[model samples]
Target: MIGFGLRLTLRGGREAAVRLVVTAAAVALGVGLILVTLAGINGVDAQNARYAWLNSGVTDATSPTAEPSPDPLWGMLGADIHDGARITRVDVAATGPRSPVPPGIPRLPGPGQYYASPALGALLDSVPAAELGARYPGRRVGTIGAAALPSPDSMIIIVGRTAEELARTPGAAKITSIATRSPGDCTGCRFGLNADVLGLILAVTSAALLFPMLIFIGTATRLSAARREQRFAAMRLVGATPRQVSVVSAVESTVAAAAGTVAGFGLFLLLRIPLADVPFTGEPFAPGDLSLTPVDVLLVAVGVPLAAAVAARIALRRVRISPLGVSRRITPRPPRAYRLIPLVLGVGELAYFVGRRPDTTNGQILAYISGILLMMAGLLIAGPWLTMAGSRIMARRARRPVTLIAARRLADDPRAGFRAVSGLVLALFVTSTAVGVMTTMIAERGVPDAGPAARGTLMVDLSRGEAERGAPEASGAPVPDRVLAGLRSAPGVRGVTVIHTNPLGTMVPVGRWHMEAGLVACEQFAGMPGFGRCAPGAVAASVPPHFGAFDTSASSAWSRTVWPAAAISAERLRDLPAQGVLVRTDGSRQAIERTRTALAAAFPDPRWPPTTVAEAGADAENARILAGFQQLAGVVTVVSLCIAGCSLAVSVVAGLNDRKRAFSLLRLAGVELGTLRRVVVLESTVPLLIAAVVAAGSGFLAARLFLEAQLQYALRPPGAGYYVMVGAGLAVSLGVIASTLPLLRRVTGPETARNE
Candidate 1:
């Protein structure tokens, strides 16, 4: 019986051969996409593992006393910003001969030596020594290995320093051994998203891509369903049992699915190298990081074919039960309005949560995710009813035979019509929600543009280790005369204001109000904007805390009372040591760079690098994170749209094949080819446009609700890219459906009218 089924599937002529080919191609694409997504998830884990050792440090259990252990190493990690790129600096000093070595380097370097990653080496070679290399002040030893670097583009430097140097540095730690896990209090060692968040993101990404693939494969397997049903019915009428017919259908579908699965694996291998170059997380992946495990390979190899066989078996249920009914072309019952209940309930669930301020407890998070999943499932369930309603409206307003014919066809089998556009609906929904949330976040958290005065002002915290530790005064040894002289004499130096913090609880007079504020040289304060000007003959001024980089919010009571106030000339404070300095430049990029270089050369410590007023307040890390999310969203949108296009094309071709006989009869009876083509266009266009609008609306609403609940962010419209993405997606789907129109004339030719 199995051999008989195989023979029938193999020798079923041109139409059967076309079906086989279409099914295979569709399955290949679907399988390939799934494999790629899995590879990316695996790669992220691998990259994280490689970085864990660097983040690990000894806890209180390992280092109980302040006294240095004989065999332990003292390590200090800091960052240096050059051209807006962060270069990670790891300073280490061996306490004994037995100190353990880190992963990438050959050995612990002595004082005045350092090892640079390949990328950092290239960058150091490209730029001048004053700008970056001056801060390192060490002889280059060897290159760090790939095992220690997160990506090929990562910039890292391991510098050797004395034990006294590390002890003087803030946030330094003792490490007995290098390990994959860090202690609980080791905050600086952690990088990127936590494990749970990363898992959630990967799961969401998989779902976003997986559903469309499933739809495409299902549509492929059901191609030419009418003809296949008729053939199966004829077999049932003869000696063939229901079980035999089911085996034949499954075998036929499995053959194509198995072939496609193998081809998809080959396609994945071909694309892996290029895919590694995609900067999904600000850094491109390593090719080996994306390699699939044996279990992953086995799953894709067997799972896709089994799923195809099951879908094929289910599609033939009618033939197995009531073959005579299928031959008579009996229509199934129309979908009821109840299909919309799930959609309403899902929206209500989200609305209920959105109305309140919910904490990020596990229950609340689960509820939010549940609401989103329900809405997604509801969209699929409610699609047929919505398509049916739209078709009915078109039928009522029909002025041409094409409109009436298309509407009737859609109304008769709305599920089949809706299936073609369902994947598209989901894709638009997911992409719209992602775009809405990310756009709002980028706008709110992005760095604000500095005004002209602020742009030229560089704030250097001269406080030794106090500023890094966030001490109350942020005060330390005063700026030496030589350091101040070098800064003033630096190129593009316009002015320098020496800052001195007033002792805690001391109030200084500024206008009628007396407040505790930092004291700055009155002569220099007059030149800086936003800070109030000093009174005439005043030698010093009492400026607000964080004076130079003060918040510019007009509504703030602090800003209202602080700026444009009185000043006092106190000679005693003028001669006091300076805890910080405000260096003003000529408001040019070159001037800023030159001034920064001079400061770097003077202050060799990387922890307290010169910072612009803008950098002090700006959330640069958050901006980078948002950019990564935007890149990921783009990849998801593109992949989903492509799969949706394929699903639309496959469905159109299959519909044409299934109705070729009917179309042929219409042509012979005087229906023009142009009119038939218009009917196809209207049928695809109405459902597509209607579903797209619903999906987009639902997506935006969900995003807004999520933001309100999670972050309490006010409602704001998504950026222009959202609209452009929707427009482009719709245009591409219509174009794909139209591409199948040329096949219409061929399928409905005069010869097609003849009985088989």
Candidate 2:
């Protein structure tokens, strides 16, 4: 029976051949997309594994120890900023002869030497010593291996320091061995998105892509349904049992599906290198990182064909029950109104969670994901009912032959019409939600706006005590006069204001508030505008304390407080060491770089690099992460829409083929080609527009609720990009449908009608 099925499928002439080819192509695309998604997920896991050791801070001892006998290594981890990019700094010192080595390096470097990642080594070679290299203050021994780096672009430096030097650094811990396990729920972990969040995002993305591909494959298999029904019914009349007929249908679908699956895997291999270049997490994946396991390959290879066969078998139920019924074109039962329940339930669930407002991060994410999944499933289920309702309205309001013909056809089989555009509906919903949340986040968390006057100013922390809490008290020495002289002589120097903090913890009365005092030289303070002017004849002035530029809480605390510039004598100022320095410059990039270079030269410690007000206000790292996600969302949306477009075109062609006899009768009765084209347009457009509006609205609502519930953010409109994404998707889909219009004349021609 299977051999007979193969013979029938292969020898069924051009139409059957076309159907087989289309089915195979659709399955191949589906398979390829799935494989690509799997690769991405695997790549993220691999990266997390490589980066695990970096976050494994001090497993041997929780705190710095004065009397450590057994531990071989003492390590301290910190971060440095260079031209808005973060560099991970690991300061390690060997306390014993047999120290455990970290991944990618041969051994811990001896004193005054360091190992840099390949990217960091290249960066060090490209730039001047003062700007970045002086910060490391060591000889570059070699490059860190790929096994130790998260990505090729990662910037990491493992500096070798003395045991005494590491003991004086804050956050240093005695390490006996390197940890191989992942850092679970470590808030201070260096990697972007923890494992939980990354897994969640990949799962959502896979679901969004996979569902559309499945729909496309199903649509592909059911092409030319009326013709297939006739062929199967004829076999029923020729003494073929219904079981035998189903086997033939399944066999035919499986062959194309199996061939396509293999082709798709080949396509994935071809695209693997290009896929690795997509920086979905601010860093591109290593090509080898994006590989599927043997089990993954086996499942996709086997499952796709099985799914296709099952779909084909289910599609032939009407033929299997009463083949004559299919030949006579009996209408199926209309979809019930209860299909709307899931949509309502899903929306209600989201609303409930939003109003209740979960306290924990995990709880909030779970609720949000559950609501989203339910809504997606609901959209798929309720689509046919909505299509039927719209078609009924169109039928009643029809004032033209195109509208009447389109409406009547859609009313008879709304499910098929809705299914054609269903992929697009889900795509728009997911895209809109993602884009909306991301845009809102970007807007709310935007860089702090210091006035234009603050642009030229660079703030440098001169207090060694500020670097690490556990550092020796002797480290808090006054800045040398030579360093001050160097800054004053640096190119683009306007003036330098030496800032001093109250070491005694004294709270001087400013207005009604007794605020902690920060002292600045009154003469230099007057030259800097926007930061209040000092009183006349005052030698020293009191100002808000200068923490790092990125310290928003401190800035906000003093924003409304009016600080009185209480005069202090120069003799008293001379008693205090300069805690920080404010260097006013020419505001040009060259000037800023030169000033930064001088500061870097002065201070070998990179922990507190010179930063401008703007640099402090802008959260570059978070922005880059969000941008990666935005790119990912955009890619998924485009792919889903393309798949939807293909499904629509195939469904349109199938519709025409199924109703060739009817359309031919209409053509012979003087129906014009333009009217027929308009009919096709109306049918695809009405259901699509309806589904899109519903999907987009639902998506926006979900996004808004999520933001309010999770982040306590106010309602904000999505950016212009959201509109552009949606508009482009609709235009592409309509264009695909229009492209299939020419096939209308071919399918319903007198020659085709006469033969059937």
> What TM-score against the true fold does each predicted structure earn?
0.90, 0.90
| Clashes per model (N, Cα, C within 3 A) | 0, 0
lDDT of 1 by residue, 529-557 (tens): 44456656667666654533443322123
* Candidate 1 TM-score over all chains jointly: 0.90
State residue 434's C-alpha deviation in candidate 2, in Å: 1.6
Predicted structure 2, TM vs. truth: 0.90
**lDDT for each candidate structure:** 0.76, 0.78
lDDT of 1 at 505: 41
- Local accuracy of candidate 2 as per-residue lDDT tens digits, 243-337: 89888998889888988898999999999999888878778888898899998899899987887777667766678887687767677789999
In model 2, which regions exceed 4 Å deviation? 60-71, 185-193, 355-365, 446-456, 462-478, 502-517, 526-544, 547-564, 567-574, 587-590, 601-604
* lDDT score for residue 487 of model 2: 85
Q: Model 1 misses residue 302 by how many Å?
A: 2.1
Candidate 1: what lDDT? 0.76
